[model samples]
Target: MSYAPSTAAGKQTAQQLADISRTLYERGWMPGTSGNISLRLPDDPGRALITASGRDKGELTAGDVVEVDALTGLASPPGQDRPSAETAIHAAVYRVTGARAVIHVHSPYATVVAHRATATDAVTSVRVERFELLKGLGLNDPTSTDLPVFPNWPEVDRIADDVAGHLAACREGPPGLLLGDHGITTWGDSLGQAKNRLECLEALCRLLVLSQSELHVSRA
Candidate 1:
């Protein structure tokens, strides 16, 4: 697929993306360059400025940003370069929610929860209950919710389709979706909002992991 360069607004969003990517990477949430971020142009919702593949997100620049077809997640104008492989999932989030920015992170805690959710037939979702960070996700303060989880598919589009289906059924939760053995996808109406949601969700996941570990220890 091909990609076009970003517009002026997208350039600013691109810079913010680079900044957040580095922060997340430093936190070990995006190790191995395993995360991706994108934002809808301020003037166009159908086109998105996405990170280019294989770039060290720690040092991303405006030049590393490219525009992609928001509906299909393919690079715009047809070219040799490609966006992140998970770009399709970002497209799905925008299509289903009308979001202007999206982020996917391969966070250790979230990845662990995702894998454990799908590693068995017992549960397919994780619960976020009575956590202070729950408020950060726009949920009721101290309320409980489910984080929808799905098993990973070799084909990214197939996973996107599944996420779209789940989203069509339920609009609540953490405002994000987790892929088994993969990571989390979150979005917002703006790049900063999207970044904040990703950060909050990752923190929530970390809390869950720690609490669960303590539970296991107590049980033992």
Candidate 2:
């Protein structure tokens, strides 16, 4: 489908997202077409531009983005490219946290930690404490916090709804979350901040996994 031409600001946002997507993809965090990134248009807070569905993250171009309603996640111009299936989740984060950018990635450590943390289906959050990297999240209490983890419901909208509910209740919570057996989502006032927080959280997950492995070996 032909998309409406983007304004200069929109073009910049798209390029920024494309650049970040390729960087993450090259790091193996967004293998295949598994991740999506978005930015709320500064001039129109009610609208957002998100990565289009099924495009290889490593090769995204400025034209690969779709402008969508921030709340409904519908294409804004009515016939633009289809937004990612997870667009609603990005919208929810923007609405709840007033974030300027949101990133979702399937990095190995974060995904593995999310999977293990949710081994008990009823688990709701993953607790991390005394991790200096927590400062990167810009949380009210970075020394320790429970990062909310939602079930990776098969229906993307259901996950979005749950995210909205949790974020609404925890207004001062971490700027990121985990999806059971899925991956991590992070947001920030800017794309650079969001990417930095994502790296911090993923590193924390890596440390958690390594510590667990050390404990297991000692026990064995």
Candidate 3:
């Protein structure tokens, strides 16, 4: 895929992505080099600016940005470096949902939720309920929303397939999903909106873990 050059704006998008990476890292949602971010070029549907692999997301810079073909998930501009190994997952979400940005992070809350949900056989059945935070999720109404959790696979394409299937079946609201023992992936119509949703999801997951811990303490 190719997009008309928006050279000036592309630089700004790179900076924005770098800023988000550092923010997520500081919050412990993306410790080490465990997350990636990508933003769609405002003027081009076929190209995206994504974080290059192996950089410390906490210290990302504009130089760490790489352009990619949004459709084929390939690096653009020929000799530019490859994107994060998870780039395919980002591309899949964009292809499936028409979203303009995506955030993936190995957050503690998200990782804990994934493990807890898997152990209890609730990976597919667990529902986030009766929380005001649900509103932030952009569901049509403030009601219980079931967030699907898929088994983790090393191959990004397999995980992407499972995510695509879940979204197809759910068929409502903003795009977000959890990979069991991995992390969360969320997207939105714009970069800011996507970042908001990612933060909200992380917060909600943390709250759930805290509440459960308190309940266990009380029971004991």
Q: Rate the local accuracy (lDDT) of all candidates.
A: 0.75, 0.84, 0.77
The true-versus-predicted C-alpha distance at residue 82 of model 2, in Å, is 1.3
Question: Which pairs, if any, clash in model 1?
Answer: 2-75, 2-76, 2-78, 2-79
Candidate 2 residue spans exceeding 4 A from truth = 2-4, 119-123, 213-220
* Cα-based lDDT at residue 212, candidate 3: 70
RMSD of each: 4.0, 3.9, 4.8
* TM-score leaderboard ranking: 2, 3, 1
TM-scores, all candidates, are 0.87, 0.93, 0.88
- Residue 97, candidate 3: Cα error in Å is 1.1
Candidate 3 residue pairs in backbone clash = none
RMSD (CA, angstroms), candidate 1: 4.0
Per-residue lDDT over 77-155 for candidate 2, one digit per residue giving the tens place of the 0 to 100 score: 8767789999999988888888888999999998987777663333377778887998887878889878777878888
- lDDT for position 148 in model 1: 80
Please report how far candidate 2 places residue 95 from its true position, in Å.
1.3
lDDT of model 3 at position 98: 85
* Residue range 96-158, candidate 1, lDDT tens digits: 888888888888887877776663222256767777787878765448778888768888898
**Candidate 3 per-residue lDDT over residues 1-220, each given as its tens digit:** 2222348788788888989999989988888888899998877879999888888988888878789988667888876666889888888887778889999899888778876664322235346777788898788866766666777776778877766666666677345777778888899988789888887777778888888753111000
Which stretches of model 1 miss by more than 4 angstroms?
Answer: 1-6, 119-123, 140-142, 213-220
Better of 1 and 2 by TM-score: 2
